[model samples]
Structures are given as C-alpha cells and as structure tokens.
Target: MSRQIQSRSYLIPIHLDENHWSLLVFNINSKQIINFDSLYNIDKNIAIISNLISILSKYVTVLKGAQNWNFFQNYSAPRQSGDIDCGVFVCQYANEVHSILNMKQFDIICFCETKIEDSYPNSFYKNDYYYKIRLDRSRHGGGLIIFIKNSFVLTKSVHPENTELIYLQFRKSGQLNNFIYTFRAPNLKEQLFLEKLEDFIHSINLNEPLFIVGNLNMDFSDKIKSNISKFADHNDLINFVKTPTSI
Candidate 1:
C-alpha cells in the first residue's frame, strides 16, 4: 500500500534485515531511484531497491504518474571503512542528498592571496555544507583557496607545480564538467608568470565552461599593461569584470 506523496523527490532509509543501512533517493522529475549504499554491495543492494521500486510501481498513483523509472546504484559514494558504521554513512548520504535538492545561491567561492600556511588546519574555515580546497603559498605573500558547495560533486582538483594556481573540476547530478581556476600572481617575475599562465590555459578544454578568477595584479582596461588581455584574446576568454576593481 503506497500513499500519494506530493514532492519532487523522496529520501527513504532502508535497513538490511537489521544488519546494515542504506539510502534510496527517488527523484520524481528524473524518474531515477538512486541507491547510496556504504557497503557498495551491488548485487544485494540493487536487489533490495529493485524490489522496493517494483512494489511502488504497482501502486496506481505511482504507476500512472511515473512509468519505467530507472534504478541506479552510486558506485562513487564513500564506502564505510568499518562494518558497524553503515548507519552513520546512511545518515551522511541522506544529508548530502537533502543539501543537493535544496541548494543555495552560490555554488563556488574563490579567494586569492589568502596567505594561508600549509600547516593551517582546514577546520578553521571548514563548512560542513561545502568542500574546501586550499593551496598554500610557496614562498611568501601568495596563497589560494576555493570552496564549493558539497551539493556539487567534486570530480578532480588540480594544482600545477611551481605555480600559484588551482583548478577544480565539478559536476552536478551527472551534468557536464565545470572547471574553475583560481590564481594569484607573485609580486615579481611578470613575464614568467604570464608564460606559465598561458601554458595552463592552453591545457584546458574549451568545450566546457571554465571560470578563471583571482588577483592577477593587472588592470583590464589597459591592453598593453595587462598582458592577460592578450592571453584572454588568444584563448577566447572574456573578462566579465567591466568596472575597475582597483585604482
């Protein structure tokens, strides 16, 4: 017996015969029933969720409203290290799903010249709802950090060697890749900086959207003074900052 629920998505916790716990996230819009199991026991977990979905499909309301709903087991979900922690993993997975469904306005945040030390503990700026990536200054007076909403899955984080830049790749619910680059130029070596920056830009895939941000110490108004403009033109990057950020 299924009751009609009027929600865009549903989160259901499943107990595996009182031994293990898992989560089922059903999105009515996508018609996807995703299983997040800490154990990653595909055969057993899929069987359980499939049985539940089959039962739900038998309901007149669900059958009429959503037909041929697909079931997917998330293999990338964090697995529990111990046998007794499946319950905790289930709760965390449910919370993550909740955050994804009700996301905030800002998905990505970047900071340059953060002056953060390598030894600095992440807990100082850690937000439970966001993923934090930090790059400490190599010499002095240069550091970078980025915070992305946990709702968006982080596919990769790339930090180029001998450079003050960090590139992060993210995806939202199986969407296309999103690349974000954060950089801060050193006070000296202007030519070397541009050359290295150009190399980094050349490495990126232009088909996907790439956001390059940070304090480059260049005035965008002056094309010659700001060598970045040339690189931007070469790489087909646009400067969204129309107004002067500094005098």
Candidate 2:
C-alpha cells in the first residue's frame, strides 16, 4: 500500500514475484505511474494497474479523489533479453529515467549568457593565449573596441583614414600572412567604408587566407556587392556563409 509521499519525489519500486522482477515509477507531484516489464497483455495489464491503484488508495487519499489515477493504457516498455536479465533491465530503466529527470532540472537553472564588467586581468586572461584589446575612445556617441587573442604575434593593421573597419594581422616567426577583419557598417558612411576597404584589400598580399566576419548592414547593391564579389573571386577567397544571420 502507498502512503503520502514527499512533494516532487519520485518513487521507483521493484516488484518481485517468486522468480520474476518488474519496475514501476511513481511521481508524487504529477501522480504519474510508469510500469515496465518484459511481457504484457492488454487485459492482464489493465487488471494489474487497477489492482495497484486500489492498493495505493487503501493507505491514502488524494485531494482530487481516487478516480484520477492514470492507468496509461496501451503501455510499452523495454523488454528483457532472458529470464535472469529482468532485474538488470529494470535497474537500467530506472537509471535512464533519473538521468532524464536530472537533465530537465538542470535545464531550468543553467545560464545562457554572462556579462563581464571588469576591465582586464580576469581569471580567463591567463589561459592558452595572450590578449590585446583596443577600447572605444569616443566621448559619447560611437564607441567600439577590438580583441585579439592567439598564440601568434599580432599587430594593429594599417587602414585608410576615417574608416570604420578594424583589421588585425597574425604573425609568427617574423612573418605576417594571416589576417582578420571586422566592421560595423553605418548607412551614412557606406560609400567611404567601401572605398577604404578596396584600398586596404589592394594594399595586402592576397596569397594567404583571410577571415572577415561582421554585420555589414548593406543589402544587394551593384556598387558594394559587385565590388565585394569581384574582390573575393579575384583573391580566391570563399564566402562559406550564405544564410541571413539576423531577422
């Protein structure tokens, strides 16, 4: 017989009759009962469920009365391979159910994003790579910064005056080849930004790989789009991303 269980507690009962063992899980909060056995029959299983419910009703009563039990008709569970494997199978089933419950509870408490307010020299700075950052020096309106972290030597890339793009090159063993560029394109400065980008591209050696990533807020246009496509094609650079990043 069942009694009043603790709130949110799950009771996994192992029922053994002579040589056979079966498993059942009872959730106190939701009043959900799950039964697992190697074999089943529709009529016999319904009778077993009814008997279990009657046994539980003898010791305690629910706030919603004894008529609200979920018998879970047409139930299906994992089967045992042999006569002696039923206990092992029940243990496995209970372990899997407990892991699933733990994962569900963790999902409710896990964090998505974290904000860092400290300046530098934090715990993460002493990892595999050294760090260099450029902070925004603007008084009020526009503020921007750049962060470069890698094993290779890094230097601030030279660009045309009054350009919005920020470029950084990675050098190793006194050789500068790899580069990364980022930009935040404003609508009013689109023309000047494109011109500056063109000038910078022409100034660099196109034989090495270059990764450029940012939100260039320009749509399909003959001026900027055509020039960018031509530059990428001429330099053997591939644009692997073809999907819309933001809606």
Candidate 3:
C-alpha cells in the first residue's frame, strides 16, 4: 500500500461507526497525521483519530522503516451547519488544500473583481507562503488582490487616488522584472477611466519592464476600434488575451 502512494501528502477518509465521516491528512513531509473534522468535536473525535493513526503507523513503520508520527487534531477547518453536510465539507477541504498546494508553482497571483470591502483585515487572507496585498473596491463593484511569494524583496508604489489600480515595484529580485500594475476599469465613466489609465501609463518608465494585467472591459475587435486598443498601441503594449471574452 505504501508503494502505491506517489504523493508526499495523502488524505484518508475515516468512517466512524458507519454513521459519521472525518478526514486524516498524512503529511510525510511534516511527519504528522493532521485530522480535520467538520464537527469540531475534540473530545469525541480525537481518540478515534488517534487510534486509527496508531494502527496505520504500524504498517507505515514496517513498510517505510521505523518513524515517529505526530498526531494533530482540532485543525481550524470549516464546520458544517447541519449533520448531513460532513461529506460535502470534507470534499471542500480536500479541494482547498489541493489548490493551495498547486499555487506553489507561481511566484505571483492576481485576483480581480474580488468584491472584498476595505473593512477586512490583511490577516483575513494571510498565508504562510505568500505576502498578500489587497486593494479595496472604490465603488460597490470590484476589488483587487495580489499575492507575491515571500522569497522576493519588493516594494509597492503609490497609485492614483480613488481608482482601481495596484502598482508593485520589485527591487534586486533576479529574473523578475521591474513593476506589476493590476487594475479593474469601471463599467461607468468610460472617458474618465480612460483618461486616468492613459495618464498612468504615460507616467511609467519606458526602460523598465512593466506588466499590466486585469479587466479592461473593452472589445478588441478590429471593427470596433476601441480607444483602449489605441491606448495600448500608442504605448506599444500587446494584448495577450486573444480569444473574445463574450459573443
């Protein structure tokens, strides 16, 4: 059974007395069996998970050689509002962990139209692996959030007031370029938005490598001939999203 396992971390769904379900994460890297129970019943579920770990550890020791396994229970996982949703919560926890693991491949991740308000604290989105920066939505429509890997030493630049833009400047970070600008254009105030965006673009240092990303909300069709395209062309910027967003 150990030979069949390829991943460094694996999940075990434990069935409790044919009625309830819980999850056990065997993280080989950490040498710990972490338990995630949607019910959050520490007194009831801890002993069951520990006994299962004790039984499983014997097989693991025999197959992979003698090893010390730590048991971690009462993990801060989401709890189910009703009794019938334990299985669904388990699936959600698995998917969330998988996504977090996969996110290790990218040095930076950007989110647009987040709809997150300014009242939320930075700790709300905190992760041990990445430094999170959030730009609150000016109006009720959209917000921006950026996650940069902790390995890089970077500084954020001042953005235009009352507009949806986040400017980050990286210094002495090898292979990573100068700046990253993320924005979400307003659906209303077309001309005002364009004017501000154009002004911001013009202020950028042409010598440095700059990446402009996020929703521009413009049709790039040849027949439409949008001002957004003209702005891009004038600045010598390329549109990488080739496919039409909508029919």
Best by TM-score: 3
**Which is the winner by TM-score between candidate 2 and candidate 3?**
3
List, residue by residue over 1-247, the lDDT tens digit for candidate 2.
Answer: 3245334434333343433445555556667666666654335555655565555555344423333656443146777555555544554555643343333332111100111223423442222333434323222112233334455576555433565455667676777764544454344465566566667776777666566655455543444666456656666677765543322
**What is the Cα-based TM-score of model 3?**
0.55
Best first by lDDT, ranked: 1, 3, 2
Full-model lDDT for every candidate: 0.68, 0.47, 0.65
Show the lowest summed lDDT stretch of 10 residues, model 2. Answer: 107-116
Evaluated at residue 127, the lDDT of candidate 2 is 28
User: For each predicted model, how many residue pairs clash, with residues at least 3 apart or on different chains?
Assistant: 0, 0, 0
* Candidate 2 Cα misplacement greater than 4 A, ranges: 1-128, 135-141, 155-160, 172-176, 220-231, 234-236
Give one digit per residue, the lDDT tens place, for model 3 in 6-60.
4667676665543456777777777777778888765776666666665566555
State the displacement of the C-alpha of residue 147, model 1, in Å, after optimal TM-score superposition. Answer: 0.7
Candidate 1 structure quality by residue, lDDT tens digits, 1-247: 3345466666766656445667888787888878888888768656656666666555535444343677788999999887766655764676644354244445776655554567767774657778888888732346676778898888888988988888877888777574655554435566677788788767876567777777676767854546778778877888888654422
Candidates 1 and 3: which is better by TM-score? 3
Worst 10 residues of 1 by lDDT: 96-105
Pairs in steric clash, model 1: none
lDDT of 3: 0.65
